[model samples]
Target: MAKTIHIALVGNPNSGKSSLFNVLTGLNQKVGNFPGVTVDKKVGSCQLADGLNATIIDLPGTYSLYPRREDEWVAYRVLMQQDKEVVEPEMVVLIADASNLKRNLLFASQIIDLKIPVVVGLTMMDIARHKGIQIDVAELERELGVPVIPINPRKNKGIQPLKKAIEQTALELYKAPVRDFINNEALAPAAIGSVKELFPELSDYKAIHYLINHESFALHGHLQEKIESIEQVNNFNHTKTQAEEILQRYQRIGSILKQSVSEPSPLKKTLFTEKLDNIFLHRRWGYIILLAVLFLLFQSVFWLAEYPMNIIDWGFGEISSWLGNVLPSGWFADLLINGIWAGLGGILVFIPQIMILFGLVTILEDTGYMARISFLTDKLMRKVGLNGKSVMPMISGFACAVPAIMSARNIENKKERLLTILVTPLMSCSARLPVYTILIGLVIPKTMFAGFLGLQGLVMMGLYLLGPIMSMFVSYIARFFINIKEKSFFILELPVYRAPRWKNVLITMVNKAKIFVFDAGKVIMVISLILWALSTYGPKEKMRSVAARYEQQIKQHPEQEAELNRLKNTELLQNSYAGLLGRSIEPVIQPLGYDWKIGIALITSFAAREVFVGTMATLYSVEGGDDADENTLMEKMNAAVRPDGTKVYSLATGISLMIFYAFAMQCMSTLAIVKRETRTWKWALIQLVYMTGLAYIMSLIAYQLLK
Candidate 1:
């Protein structure tokens, strides 16, 4: 039998832990939340060797075992084996950046002192050498009492050796360190001894952590009291002890590096990252470059995706037509074609745009420009009662608010984090892309300016930018009322720019497309089917009367059979159950230039923003002619007319709807995540009410002004 062993990959932020996990696990990984926490838990299976399988756990990155943030607490719990659900790793792979060994070694030394099996995977060796630094791997390994493998997971260098080392280490019995990385016993002897009394199996270093961080641990009340008594009796000063411990570790690390590593004097040379920051980080030019980058991103979403989108549209239409011909004229056939297929086609046709949008964003992240975006916007963010750290989550809102709000855990300041979570959904997520694209096509011209700039693309960029702009205003006002008084700071590390890995980019694009087609598709499928029923069948008496009236008209005007049939279908749909429901809300949304059909879509799409398109598809398909000349959703919407014989999707209506979607908190998932992250429905409810009110007011003004 091939027994499985557990291995954990741990490292600091941006130390290439995820990159290595991706390389080792390939497509054999799944992402989920940790037990009792919303922090991401990424686990994957790997074959180390014959009869030895490895389950790789990628822990969230942190500077040290010291816990502050929720994610840090998760990493600490798993490492200490205190978490009942997450099993402790048999072996730990400590990813270290060769370029910055001193800071990296601080964490490595702490883990070593815990007496667990550790393997140091040294990354960024090329970057280190480029900076005139050199390290002897054997000497480092010997000094740290672990196997140090110099590997570059990004380039697929030395990965086989790294895996073999993990297998060999896991199979062997773990050995306690012969000596502590630093004098753990000397730092706080009395407290360590007292804690060890409670936890007899703990190492000297782990005991020291227990004394320092006992409050955060999952401990019995009596046990907590005992630890507090130990702290009081010993007159322990946590801040002073932490500082002394760090100073001692750095002294020993400096001694070890003198024998194992060499580097040029810091005063003599400037690194490449600093040199490039001159332009990309420039005060004035930086913003210009950011604008240009954003403009290009939005433009590419339309330009590159147009052909593929059209093909998908044409393909779906052909399939629907073919099925309509081959199948019998009955209820099942109508449901299959107009209900299910129509909904699916509406959502799937936008996959090309989603892929391109995510692919470009991935490139920005891989090239390290995304961090620079934070740096450039830090001043503005601070003015709005936030800092540079809030910029990442706000930008991540472009993908989805649920994850973006969850990512706010990295923000150390509670008030700013809450504010960030509250306002992130205001940013236009990918779900809004279909709505924006369809509406923009109706309202904005595809004219090109200066033979290069696209008018429609420019509008798309404005919509994305609008969310952040509004978020700043909202946060600035809300900060005064939320009475959390704490000092906030923004300290960020800017990684060196490198060429994006094309493989990763492609993988990201494929994964995003799959999520849209599968996850969002399921929701769209259900809504579409339900909508078909509602649009097809009405109250029995009403439905019978509609059929009777249509039959009489067909009998009276037998010569105009095709035209009369089209009129009959429209009348049948207008009086159906869906139409009745839509009409009930028509009075409220009519001021925004929406009809009853649009009203139905608005109500159902609260489940998810993208469902608006699927809802529209079902409604129009039910009313559309059965002839083969039926148009796409966009064309149908464009040709649609109100009862007054005016265009349904006129310029005012389209723009007002776009503005409405831009500000509305329409996603229930986003609201749920906000409540979970904030740990209170009060904030979530406030967010919902304010965003909805803002969306309505702004949309109303826009519609009335244009009308």
Candidate 2:
């Protein structure tokens, strides 16, 4: 029987660790939460030579053994074997960026102390050569006492050898005494003495972790007596004093590099990196470029999706029409065609937009310009009480809020992370785009605003822009109240620009698009079906009586029969289950200028914003009449009159509805994710109450003022 070997890939942030993992594992990966924390655990399996297999766990990137954030803490925990459920790796593959060896070596040395089988995979060797840096691979391997393989993961080079080294090392077929920490001679005696006195059984790395103030040491109850003994020997605080000692170790590593590493020439600054950064990161031009890029992105989503959207629309219509003709014209037939089909149609029509947006984002991220954008925006973000870390998640909100909130885990500060999560949903996600597009199309004239800008497009742009403005306002206010004083710094690695790997981008695009279509599709479909049943089969006596009364009039005046049947169907719908439900809530929404039909759509739309269009389609389709066009729906909505003869869906009502969606907590998945991330219901509740209240007040003002 072949044993399953475990390998851990460790590296610093932006070291191409994830890209390497993707190359190695491909589709043989699964992402799960670390035992108890929200930190993600990515594990995959790969088949090695000789029919052997290995499970590779990609640990979160950390600069040192000392962890500052929860995700990094999970990494430390896994490596230390502090948790019973977490397994220690048989071998550790330490990935280092060749161009930035000084910073990358800091972690490499820490891993060497762990006594695990280790191999060094030097990434970004191409960039290093471009910058006139050269490494003697044989000398590096000898100096590190382990195999050092130079790799360009992006180009898929040096992968096979790296895999073979891992497999060979895991089988204990190779062993070498790696170079140990050199400059910590003064602290070694004290470190060993404390280990012997306090944690006699602990590994050297675990002892080092205790010396460096890792909290897991304290969590080990078995070490309490030893810790007390060590404390008595040293009057100094172990964590703080030892951290200073660790800094000396880093200095020693620097000395080793100075002696072993040589630069072929004075480090030459590349004009390419500098020139690109000059324009893309310019203070004034950067913002302009960002806005232009965003505008183009949105424009592409709208203009490009039209063809596919039309195809999907026509397909759904055909399916509904066919169902209507074949089914027995009863509740079941109505449910299949109008309810389920319409609801699903509303969800599926947005697939093209989602794919295009995600593909663009993936390209930006893979090319590494996203990091520069984060760096460029950091100063501005700090002024509003956020950091560079908040930008990606905030930008991600434009695509979807659930993942945006989940991405906040990268933020280390609890308060800052919470604030980011709280306000992220307020950013208009793609779900709201459908609502805004439809409403703006109806209310805003297509003519230019001030004879230069497209008014409708500008209004849509304004709605998108409103979200960040509101998020910043909320974050600023929260910052003032929260008493956090930790000094935050932004340290981002701007990777060398390279052609985006289209394969990776396409895979990401497909995954994200699939998630949206399937996850959101199921909810909309079920709701639509339920709604169809309600609309098709009401109180039988009421519908039968209404139809009979209309039939009598039709028999008396044959020419009026068509008009009378239309009236009878409308009346039946008003008395149906869905209609009764809508009527019950009419009084509450009357101030917003919505009638029973709009009320029904609003109720169904709580499941998803795009469902509103589907609800309208289903209600109209069940009437056994001609399919309503965009113009027809708008005209019917505009001409709807309340008991007092006031028009429903007027300019005031449309604007109010749009504003309502702009700030409302309309997404349940977003709420559920918030709850999962915060690990409490309190924050999610706060989001729900505040966002709903804000939406209600804003909508009320718009309706009242416009009225």
Return the TM-score for each candidate structure: 0.84, 0.86
Give the local distance difference test score of model 1: 0.82
**Candidate 1: pairs in clash:** none
Across 586-663, the per-residue lDDT of candidate 1 in tens digits comes to 998999999888887776677678778767766666333233323476788888998789999988898899999999
Please, what are the lDDT tens digits per residue for candidate 2 over residues 133-237? 777778777667777888877789999998888777876776635445543434545655676565576555556566555435436665665655565576536
Per-model root-mean-square deviation over C-alphas:
4.6, 4.1
How far in Å is the alpha carbon of 222 misplaced in model 2? Answer: 5.1
Count clashing pairs, candidate 2.
0
lDDT of 1 at 496: 89
- What lDDT would each prediction earn against the true structure? 0.82, 0.74
Worst 10 residues of 2 by lDDT: 619-628
